[model samples]
Target: MAKFFGNLNAVLVGGLAVLIVIMFGLHSAVLGESIYPNQLFRYLHVLCGIMWIGLLYYLNFVQVPTMPSMPDELKPAISGHIAPRVLFWFRWAAAFTVLTGLIVAHLSGYLVEALTFQPGVVLIGIGMWMALIMAFNVWFIIWPAQKKILGIVEASADEKAAAAPRALIASRTNTLLSIPMLYCMVTQNALGV
Candidate 1:
């Protein structure tokens, strides 16, 4: 058990297998085949969203704040090793979240109406737009800047100096946007907001 849990790839695959089993076990409620694309995409969206936002919070709440206080030598461990890997997952999760969300929206037949901010879907549309913007920030803004900041790309000293603040501000902007994004996602359907 410890060995399995210690291997992230194994853990993720095992967890997914368990989830599939549980879903199949609830056959009466799930009717898995009948709800294939829509349900599957929605599930993927939520799963990707959790990973995206979870990393965002980890960066904002834990990593960024803690960096300034770390010893310079220790900082390399995070900046060189951890940040790159985390950003890899972060950016891909952001992309997948948007992709799966669009798939779910299209499959449910409201992609146009929602994007147009039609009355019933205004809140979700707002959330979707916010998420799209955040994803853009993750991919185009944050990742590029992070590459420079983390030395994944060769940058002039001046460029590296510029990159850090750029990445930080974009990440902070996403963090701020996440609050309302989450609110809209949860409240849109439930409260008819």
Candidate 2:
């Protein structure tokens, strides 16, 4: 048990298997059959968004802020190991979050409603577009820059150094956008657009 738990892939797979088994035995054979596909998709979108934004906050609020004061030797662990791995999750989470969110709107038959700037759905559209832009920046701008900065692939020292600030700025923009994005997503519905 301990050995199985010690391996990340094994633990993740094992835990998911346990969860599925429990859900099947305790309740319905298919867990999500009760909800509309859009509802399920939205729920999953929120889940992925949490991971994406949670890591974003970790990078911006915790890691980057602390890095400058750390010893140079310790810094490489962050730049090389921790960052590359965290970003793998971060960027992919952003991508799925956006993709599923769009699909959810489509599934709900709101894809046109949301995008067409109908008075009722426009606010939600704003939040969706915000998320889309941030995810785009995450996958296209930040990840590429971070690849260089984190040394996941070889780059000249100067190239690495150059990528660092550009990545940070893109991250900062996401942080700024995230605040209003959250507000619009929640209140957009509650407040009647």
Candidate 3:
């Protein structure tokens, strides 16, 4: 059990196996029907969204604040190793979240209505547009700036300096948008809007 849990791949596979069982066994029994594509995409969307937003919060609430106080000698550990890994996951999670979310909306037959902000789907449309903007920031603005800030790509000292604020502002914008975005997503179903 220790060995199995110690390996990330093994743990992920185990978790997936459990999900398969629940989906086929419990879910089917409860719903009396197989899972639909929309449901699957919704699940994926929620999963990826968690990773993306969680990382975003971590960067804002923890990493950025802590960095200034961190000792210079120890900074490289975070910048050289940890930050790169975190950014890789962060950017990919952002991409997958958007992809899955769009698929969910499309499968649910609300892609056009939501995008266009039609009457009934106004809440979800707002959420979708916010998410799309955040994802665009993640892929285009933040990631490119981060590449410079993290030394993943070549940049002069002045260039890296310029990148830092660009990345921070974009990330902070996403953080600000996340609050309302999440509210719209959660309340859309509950309010029956």
Candidate 4:
């Protein structure tokens, strides 16, 4: 159990297997049909969104604040190793979240309406647009800056200095957008809109 739990791939596969079993059982009993594409895409969207936003919150609430007090010698462990890995998951999760969300909207027959902010889908449209902006920040703004800041790309001292604030601003912007974005997403269903 310890070995299985300690291996991330194993744990993820095990969890997915469990989910599949549960889904099949429930769907067979209740719906008497296969899982819908929209439902699958919605689940993927939620899963990826959680990873993206959870990492964003971790960076803002934990790493950023804790970094200042960390000793200089200890900093490399974060910047050189931990940070790069976090950003890897962070950017990809952001990309997948957006992709899955778009697929969900498309499969649900709201792609055009939501993108155009049609009357009935205004809340979800707002959430979708905000998520798009946040994903853009993750890929275009934050990732580039982070490459420089973390020395993944060669950067001059001044370049690294500039990247820090750029990344920080974009990250914080995403964090800010996530609150309303999440609210819109969650409330849209509750409000029956």
Poorest 10 consecutive residues of model 3 by lDDT? 28-37
Model 4 TM-score?
0.94
Cα lDDT of candidate 2 equals: 0.86
Q: Against the true structure, what is every candidate's RMSD?
A: 1.6, 2.7, 1.8, 1.7
Off by over 4 Å in 4: 29-35
Q: For residues 87-106, could you state the per-residue lDDT of candidate 4 as single tens digits? A: 99999999999999999888
Query: What is the lDDT of every predicted structure here?
Result: 0.92, 0.86, 0.92, 0.92
56: Cα error in model 3, Å: 0.4
Report how far residue 166 has shifted in candidate 3, in Å: 0.4
Tens-place lDDT per residue, model 3, 108-128, is 888899999898899999999
Once superposed on the true structure, which residue ranges of model 3 sit more than 4 Å away at CA?
28-35
Assess the local accuracy of residue 3 in candidate 1 as a C-alpha lDDT between 0 and 100: 94
Q: By TM-score, is 2 or 4 better?
A: 4
The list of candidate 1 runs beyond 4 A from truth reads 28-34
lDDT winner between 3 and 4, please give it. Answer: 3
* Tens digit of per-residue lDDT, candidate 1, span 1-193: 8898899999889999998787777754766465676888898999999999999999999999999999999999998999999999999999999999999889987788888999888898999999999999999999999999899999999999998898999999999999999998888778664
What's model 2's lDDT at 136?
A: 82
TM-score for every candidate vs. truth?
Answer: 0.94, 0.85, 0.94, 0.94
